[model samples]
Target: MDAADAMAYLFSPQGRVDPYPAYERLRAHGPVVEIAPGLYVATGYAAIDEVLRDPRYEVTHEELTQHPVAGWAESPAVASLTGSMLRANPPDHGRMRQLVAGAFTPRRVAAMRDVVTAQATALVAEMARRGRDGATLDVMDEFAYPLPIGVICALLGVPEADREAFRGWTVDFAAVLEPEISDAELAVADRGAVALRDYFRDLVEARRRAPADDLTTALVQAHDAEAGRLTGDELLANLVILLAAGFETTTNLLGNGLVVLLRHPRHAAALRDDPALAGEYVEELLRIDSPVQVTSRKATVPVTPGGVPVPAGGRVLLLLGAGNRDPERFAEPSRFDPTRPHNQPLSFGGGPHYCLGAALARLEAQVAFPLLLRELPGLALAGEPRHRTRLTLRGYATLPVTVDADQHHRVVVPVPAGERGTPTGAGSGTP
Candidate 1:
């Protein structure tokens, strides 16, 4: 396919299913290619990296509003989205980010390791119970989806019962991020935006009344030494961003990682033998099939990403999925190699707009992968996996897998005298 055809395919259902072949075509064209009259796409590693880190390339509310969907101008989704740090620039972005940064500290994220492990283990055990008779378990719905939601909701002080409701709300709100959503989808997203805002308003009010050690309380009560506190809208909007971002990406990560491991049983066994390799394995999984496929930035002034001029105010969709697979940056980019050296995939982006929850997301994946593999040794795909109909977030909506309690009984060493409990579902693998 020609560069134009390849770029066009990205918006088509076929391309959404698997865009790597199209990415190769675009890369073959050049570092960057003008996909449309005013829009461009960056496919090369160095080119995408430069664009992500470039100060001249930025996200702005004004740019996001341009050529928006049919009813987006007056939609509540637009109102909430426009106030978020995701679309802001300069002073506003810097100030809000600083407030959030204080709460999402490394120490705070590291504290969730035990929480993640416990949640994953419980889910795997539940799967074993349901699948004991050789029934297929929908791992995505039962395991992958709930882990991050439980973790993030707990961290944000959101009640356990409300987490499921938020899942539906997030699914609706996600349509706002798409490029060509319909009027009907916009209406659904509008209602979702309103519902989310109302829910957060009450939560923020409660936090104000009596603050706690959770991130929500920190954000609600945060005060900059000079910049003052976040406005009502700012606080509410960012809370929504945190809630949505906190879980959505990590959910995809867990699902995608499991799919890869199931495809390569040796790697799964390696991780089962020694869970320490999870950190490295997670990184490679992210590089090969990133949860977030693309992000856009606008040119503030006339500039060039790959020696091709982009007029001021023009938009460039940075193909992060394509960039991660650029042969120039990674040898045998398509191959999944866990032990790869100096692997710096732009999965979380870079520069000022980098994802604030990156560390937390990484932590969850690192903790969850090991638990799933160790707890379910015979975990294998039971049916055809179904990917979500989403262009940006690539993940399975349903992953059917069967687990064998007996298969998980493989032991490398003699079980300790007192440590050997009945291998009902926990199995004898203690690694």
Candidate 2:
């Protein structure tokens, strides 16, 4: 396909299933290809990287957001999103991020190692048990969705019993982010946004009355102005986005990572044999198949990215997936080789607007993947994998899989983070 055709194809259902080939087609044209007047799509690593880190290339803040998502003010989903740091620029973004950054510090994420281990183990073991008889299990439903949701819930101080409700809310909140949305979908997303907003409001009040050792309580303190600088609206919007975004990225990462590993059993075997290698493997997996595929930025002044001049007020859609596989940056771009030196993927984005929970998401993948490979010894795909029809938040909706009946995994013992290099005794049914 030509560059324009390739760009249009990205919004097609077929393109959404697998867009790498199309991305390559776009790359063949140039690093950045303008599909419309004052608008461009950056398919090369260098170009997208430059724009992402450049202050001149700004995110669409609330005032600018209306230009694209018209009627955003009336939509609850769009309002919640535009209010959060996700849409904030500079000073406001910095202030809000600082207030919540404490929750995801290195020490904090490291402390959650035990929590992730236990949650992933329990979920994987449960899948093993259900599939012990060669019964097909949708691993996406059984493992991928639950593990990340559980972890995010744990982080937000959400009680385990109340975690089930977030799934639907997440689906609703996420719908508004896709490449296309119908009126019905928009309505659903609005309801979902309102529900999430109200839920967090109640949650904040509860935290105020009976403070807990979770991020919610900390945010409450910040919102009340006694400890930090958050407004009540800021607290509500952030809480809604945090819980929704916190799980969304990791959920897609795990789902996409599994499909990659299952297709390349050799690499999966290697990871299982040496869990210590999971860190590098996860990076490669992320590079090969990014979860958040597209992000756009508007120009504040006339500037060039990848030698292509963008006039003032111009916009560029950063094709992150394409950038990750740019041949100029990565040798044999499409190949999934963890041994590549200096693997720097844009999966989590870059610069000021980079994902705040990036480290936490990486940790979740690193811990969960090895545990899965080791525990499910003979795990394999049982049927065609189903892809979620989303160009932005791309991943599998269902992955039919089964394990060797005789080798089904037993309950997992929580493995401490420091001891990851050592084997956790997978087949022996002991941690």
lDDT tens digits by residue: candidate 2, 1-431: 67668877876788888887788788888999887777788999999889999999778633312135455568989888878888788788898889889988899999989989998899989988888787878888898889889988888898888888888888878877765555676788898998888888888888999999899998888777664488777888888889988998899999888877776666677789999988888898889889989888899999989998899989888889999989899876766677667998999889998888989899999999998889998787776788887777888888877777353442222322321222222221112
Please provide, for model 1 over 1-431, each residue's C-alpha lDDT reduced to its tens digit, 9 standing for 90 to 100.
77768866776777877777788889988989887777888988888888888999888444332245676678888778778888788888998898788656899778778888888888878987888877768888888889999988988899888888988898788767765466887898888888999999998888888887787888776732234568778888888888888888888899988877776566677778887787888898899889888788899999999898999998888888899998889876876667778888888888898999899899988888888888777787776677776667777778877786454432232322322222211112222
List per-prediction Cα lDDT, in the order shown: 0.79, 0.81
- Model 2 lowest lDDT segment of ten: 422-431
Best by lDDT: 2
- TM-score per prediction, in order, is 0.90, 0.90
* Best candidate according to TM-score: 2
lDDT comparing candidate 1 with the true structure: 0.79
Query: Which residue pairs clash in candidate 2?
Result: none
Model 1 bad stretches (over 4 Å):
62-68, 223-228, 405-431
